[model samples]
Target: MALNEQLNKFQKQQVKCQSTLSDIASSRTSVGPSRSSVPAAISQRPVATAPVRFSNDTVRLTEINNIRKSPVGSQMKRVIQLLFETRQAFTPEQINEACYVDMRANKAVFDSMRNNSKAYFDGRRFSYKATHDVKDKMQLLSLIKKYPDGIAVSDLKDAYPNVLEDLQALKASKAIWLLYSQEDIAYPNDLKCDMKIEDDFKALFRNKDVPTDMLEVEKELLKIGLKPASNTAERRAAEQMLGVPSKSKQKKKKKQEISKRTKLTNAHLPELFQNLNPSGSQN
Candidate 1:
């Protein structure tokens, strides 16, 4: 009985050791491999990811949100007001810093102002163009008189909003003269020096049957005791009209002729060889 009890105790101890070993094996399996077992290349390799791209609208919205966090009212109005108050030009970045707004948000305002012709942009800077003080015909006339060479009508239009009506009134009263060229210009009229052209002269100019030929025109001028233009400029213009080449063109032709005469060719080689052959024969 003592021997059988000792044998049973030994068998129970062995079974317990086996169960502990099995539990350890199962735990190891559940935990996965150790860090040391992973390959070095895979462990060190960088993971690939897709790059992030934002659309124009998303970027614009983000910029607006970022800028709108400030206490400023309208970004555009603030920029314009700043420019007007300072009466100076500013770049988008400068304007942003001055108004404490983002440049991206202000750019849209600048573009809108430019498109609407409410502001002036000289490639890099923006300025309020309608800051002129002229408000009526008298002021407009005074402004015109200040510039003897004349002022551009477009500039006047910018200076005074209702400048067109005032300009017509001034012209009717002979207070100013409008000269049309590539651009319309306003010149202050001096009635003392202004000569009235006869209606007959205007009629002659407007007549379709009036001679278009230069010689016929010259004859009419001669009949009226008026001499045709005899200045160097007039002569050159006449020469151009007659299809005569200019002095520069004539010089170019002369240079070409001289070059052709001086140029040596294979055709001259035979003569040169003949001259040399006579000397060779004498030798």
Candidate 2:
């Protein structure tokens, strides 16, 4: 009986050892190495990822097909291309129709492109940068010519919000005229009398030419704020201003020549009379 019990005890001990070995193996597979066992360099290393980037030409091309294909990227390219090609200020609905993309769904795409592509394109609420400049140059001069009373700056801003830069450029070149309001005048001396008479003098000044006749020149001078005949006795002032020689000066020069001719004729008279009558007879 004792021998049989010892054999059973030994078998149970062997089973316990096998179970302990199995548990150790399972634990090792389930939990990996402890944190302390890991090397300091391996534990502290940062996770790496691929860099995100877009091509510079992505913003420049005016056709969707020109850009690499992607859902958001293709839509953005289409929107940009449409804006560039039409050269028109568009409403959100118009943009939707034109690009065939939903502004709501692609808000992120548009926003991203707008932020990224400002140097290449400036897209505003109702206007685009490139077209605004062209239109302003084409229309501003003609518009100024049409409205001699002066067009309101507010009206211009509303029509072309992006046009301030264009205006500044034209103004700097003196190609466009500015009309100051009474409120804008800091002092009475600051008021420009000539510009008041003509809202834009650049156009008028360009149209006028120096007339040949002093009288006609006088008439044109009157139209441009030069005082009429009686303002003062500044002789030939208009001619001098026009860079022309005065008619009076010309007349005086001609008279001097005629007087010289008369004096020469008188001097020769005695010789001719002597030749006709050698007896010095009076005829």
Candidate 3:
């Protein structure tokens, strides 16, 4: 009986050892994290994504395309404001940048501005032409400011050309007419006369052949706060070289010639009549 009891006790001890080993392994097998573990496993979540909105032009893609709120109305008003601000002439890329397109507008916005525009074109770049008549001349003038009297057509795009048409028009109309004459002075004939202000402003009382007294005339006009007819130092210099018109001088010369002719005719009259004796006798 003692031997059997001891065997049973030994078997029970073996069973307890096995149970401890199993418990230790089971504790390890439990999903609970250990002190040595880097971290516990956590439920995974999908990454948040922005809404995709692809448009026709890949070059114009922007982050704001996925905006949840509708800014269409306010954005449109601002775009319109910018459009009116474009009263000044501009190039295409210049206009696009001014509209703050990417930040405020999209491809649709630019399309809307261009939708009704018949005068604008994109070539070489973009240009908003005025009427073709004015457009070409304005362009030519713009070039002429950089290039003086003459420039070549082939070189104009990069090397400006002379625009004679505009100039000839200005010259013919005498919009830049030189003051050529001093006529009968009516209201307040004084150079400093307030009455002459209107004529001065209208450029009607130009000193057509300015006298040797041109400086004196200008000084007197200045004394009365009246600006001289000239617009520039060069113009004043031009007017300075100006003299009384040949037309008026010609009239004076003709009058003198007529007076001399009248005197000579009177003096020769008696002699000529006497020399007509043969004709008179025949009569």
Best by lDDT: 1
Task: Give the higher-lDDT candidate: 2 or 3.
Answer: 2
lDDT of predicted model 1? 0.65
The better-scoring model by TM-score among 1 and 3 is 1
All-Cα superposition RMSD per candidate: 27.9, 24.6, 29.0
- Model 1: CA > 4 A from native: 1-132, 194-283
Q: In angstroms, give how far residue 109 of model 2 lies from its true place.
A: 1.3
Model 2 Cα lDDT, one tens digit per residue, 148-209: 55555555553354566766666666655665775211111122443544536646664566
Tens-digit lDDT string for candidate 1 (1-283): 3322443454565566667667766775664666367688875665343333333344444454455464434666676677666768988777755754554554555566566445678888887667456767787889889888988888877564467989989999988889999999989887788788787886666555767456778888889999888445577788999999775867865543422234346552343323332322342
**What is each predicted model's overall lDDT from 0 to 1?**
0.65, 0.52, 0.42
Best by TM-score: 1
Task: State, as a TM-score between 0 and 1, how close model 2 is to the true structure.
Answer: 0.22
The C-alpha stretches of model 2 lying farther than 4 A from their native spots are: 1-69, 116-126, 131-283
